[model samples]
Target chain A: MEDPRNRQYTNDEITVFWKPAKCVHATTCFRELIEVFNPGRRPWVDMSAASTQRIIEVTDKCPTDAIVWKYNKDLSENELQASTSTSEEVNPETLSTDPETKPAKVTIMKDGPIVVEGEFKVIDSNGNELKSMIMTSFCRCGGSHSMPYCDGRHRKIGFNDKK
Target chain B: MKEKSAQFRVIENKSLEVSGSFEIFNAKGELLKSEGPIYLCRCGLSENKPFCDGKHKNSGFTG
Candidate 1:
């Protein structure tokens, strides 16, 4: 079983496992706490960047269990095996290639960008097809120089939903 | 019901033109929009919220 994408990070108190294939770019981890789960940094996740309690709080917010954490002592045999063997559990995503399933899902993140996930097509104002994607985040605070796509400008600008 | 396709058009820094059969939920999991051909605010200054109300004009809201 060749699992090159499986990455594990530890901080003596807990271990965080990452499954890249399961990531839907929900941005919860980075949006909530970027110090630990920065996508820009190589190896991408730094468990030592934050406290174990803070890391757990952000990791648990992942919509898909792409990133999961377990206490050093609480990890069961199966969890340890999870790092080496591919689990038989299948995560169902609406973005599957099934054309007859349903419409894509649009979810607004709390005080963050709008996360659009599932099968969908994007077109420019000129009606040109931009790119088809299963998951993407759109800027809601209208500060992204990248236009519609989120470039994490909302956080820099301190975008607030209420006031 | 027949399957519906989702389409999003970036309307030149004004708004996002979204169409097709879909449901939109806010951060609180509340249904925001669930219909067709709606212009969502892109300038972050919509008084009406989420939906566009032509506020992009004069807001210096460049892409």
Candidate 2:
């Protein structure tokens, strides 16, 4: 079966593949190019939002090779068709709402919170919402008093990005 | 029996308390411990390392 999470984003010139299984969630892609690789958005990648060269530059920074790209001219007929079909189905807003389409992947942020996506239950010490986040950061710096949810305190206290 | 989700609690500005089914590993990916409500230092000044020894109060850690 084709892996649902193994997705591709294509512009008119090139296509970028996102293998969620290979992602370490170093946050390099989104941190460097939020306009194109926004984690908060469904489908999580917008190939048309940025230039092909810029997307390639950011994709190179992905430590795990989770994001890779190729020119559209290099693709086979089947690949070209698949890329077009995928783009037609691309709706960043509705991608994750269907539980069957995407299983949650927990991304260990570099010296930050555990960013969880897809479907999962999060409970606090008192079992509160702390907040039900689709893509939320959990404190790994051991600094957040809010427990699982990040309060952006890591930046205030100088939490080391390398742990 | 099902495994319980991991738990983490912040002891004010002192330390972070972690416990449950989750595992804590070092940079080398070695398993640290399972039974711990491990108290990890948040003050960024722990000499004992990872664990807290009431240094937050002395260091004036506001986190």
Candidate 3:
């Protein structure tokens, strides 16, 4: 049985499937391509904002298969029917609040930023609350134009984790 | 004791000081550290990789 909450977003060429149950909120989708996967907006996934090739590129980065894509011509009959219906679409905003209050997870990506997720507070050097967010990546390469955040500069400078 | 949420503090031109309840994992999904008040390298000059080793001072990292 198809999940009632599952959503399918389509452009002229491709359709993106969203399975909320499979989303661990690793936040890879929005962080990689917010122009298409912005969680703040209604209907959340805007396939038309980006090219099919670009959308597929970011969708492949999803740690989990919460979001995946298929060509419009390849969609099965049932899937094609679901794609046309907007009445069943659910808001991604309602899924923001994490149900489990587990301690935040800080993962150190090799040759990359420190990815933090779950409930957390960020404070500047002067002890002022910077902002509270569900997920964020801190730059370890020290070359980010956006201070304290990873702007993907490590790759440009060829940062290597020797360990 | 009531467990508090994790807190991350960005030190000026230096490391990121993390405290409170949280878990830290290495690149291979291994649990590296979970205790409070840990200093992580942000200046990218640390010989110790993820941990700060006072290399920022020499590197003159201002961010």
Which candidate number would show the highest DockQ if scored against the true structure? 3
- Per-residue error for B41 in candidate 3, Å, reads 0.6
DockQ for the candidates, in order: 0.70, 0.17, 0.72
Per-candidate clashes, comma-separated: 0, 1, 0
Tens-place lDDT per residue, model 2, B8-63, is: 55555566665555555444446555565666665555555455666677666664
User: Chain A structural similarity (TM-score) per candidate?
Assistant: 0.55, 0.54, 0.63
The sequence of per-residue lDDT tens digits that candidate 1 reaches over residues A77-98 is: 8666665544333221222444
Steric clash pairs (candidate 3): none
Please provide, for model 2 over A1-163, each residue's C-alpha lDDT reduced to its tens digit, 9 standing for 90 to 100: 6556467788888888877667655666764565687654566687877789999999999899878888988987866666644433332222445434333444444444444444444544454534344444455455656543454456557777433
lDDT of each: 0.74, 0.59, 0.82
* Off by more than 4 A, model 1: A2-16, A20-27, A30-57, A63-65, A69-100
Model 2 docking category: incorrect
- Chain B TM-score, candidates in order: 0.84, 0.84, 0.92
Measured on C-alpha atoms, candidate 1 has an lDDT of 0.74
The Cα error of candidate 2 at residue A27, in Å, is: 9.7
* Decreasing TM-score order of the candidates: 3, 1, 2
Q: Compare the candidates by TM-score and give the number of the best one.
A: 3
- Per-prediction TM-score to the true structure, in the order listed: 0.69, 0.47, 0.72
